[model samples]
Target: MRWKHIVAASLVLASLSGCSWVNKLVYRIDINQGNYIDQTAVEELKFGMTKEQVKFLLGPPMLVESGYPNTWYFVQYLKPGHDAPEQKELILSFDNSGQLVGMKGDYQPGSGFFEAVR
Candidate 1:
């Protein structure tokens, strides 16, 4: 009789495992990953600034493709406990001389971003 009770309890737990609401009973920590550059730092980027200057301001990029040395990719992702995840990205392009020339992706550049210092 005791064995039968244990088997029945096991079956009940196995069924509850697939229920989504069961997850709410457990606590989860917030998750933050990747290079998290703030809007102010990105706004500080100037068109004619060198790669080193950008790195100093925004830290290292998340990826630099092998053939695309002039492009830098910055990514940030965050998941707060049970809330939905959020992601932000910024792509910077440099000219042949390694001066930053283009910016794109989710981040918006500041007012003077396009005014190149020729």
Candidate 2:
């Protein structure tokens, strides 16, 4: 009877442990969504840059709701086969004249953010 219990326990443990290796055998492609902005691009942003200028640098934003025309949202989501998924966001606020005035979210503004583009 004790031997039967040991076999059952071993089977249960094996079944549980087997899942991890089985999962590894399957292939998973890395998934990337939305704009992929690098640090250099973020560093190029200037305080008074126009919407067109910002667009030229960072490309189109992920979200620009109709209700919030002055606010632009840049989002990036990355999922790897065997690693944790990562998400990044950048929110830019513009003035009534469509000039960049504020920036927020995961990314930090560059040192030249205070300087206007010539």
Candidate that would win on TM-score = 2
Q: Per-prediction TM-score, please?
A: 0.78, 0.84
Q: What is the C-alpha lDDT of each candidate?
A: 0.91, 0.92
In model 2, the number of clashes is: 0
lDDT of 2 by residue, 1-112 (tens): 9999999999999987878887888999999999898878998898899999999999999999999999999999999998899999999999999999999888878899
Candidate 1: worst 10 consecutive residues by lDDT? 16-25
Clashing pairs in 2: none
Off by over 4 Å in 1: 1-22
Tens-digit lDDT track for model 1 on 1-118? Answer: 9999999999999897775787887899999999987999888888899999999999999999999999999999999899999999999999999999899999888877877676
- With a 3 Å backbone cut-off (N, CA, C), the pairs that clash in candidate 1 are none
Tell how far residue 48 is off in model 1, in angstroms.
Answer: 0.6
CA RMSD per model (angstroms):
4.0, 3.4
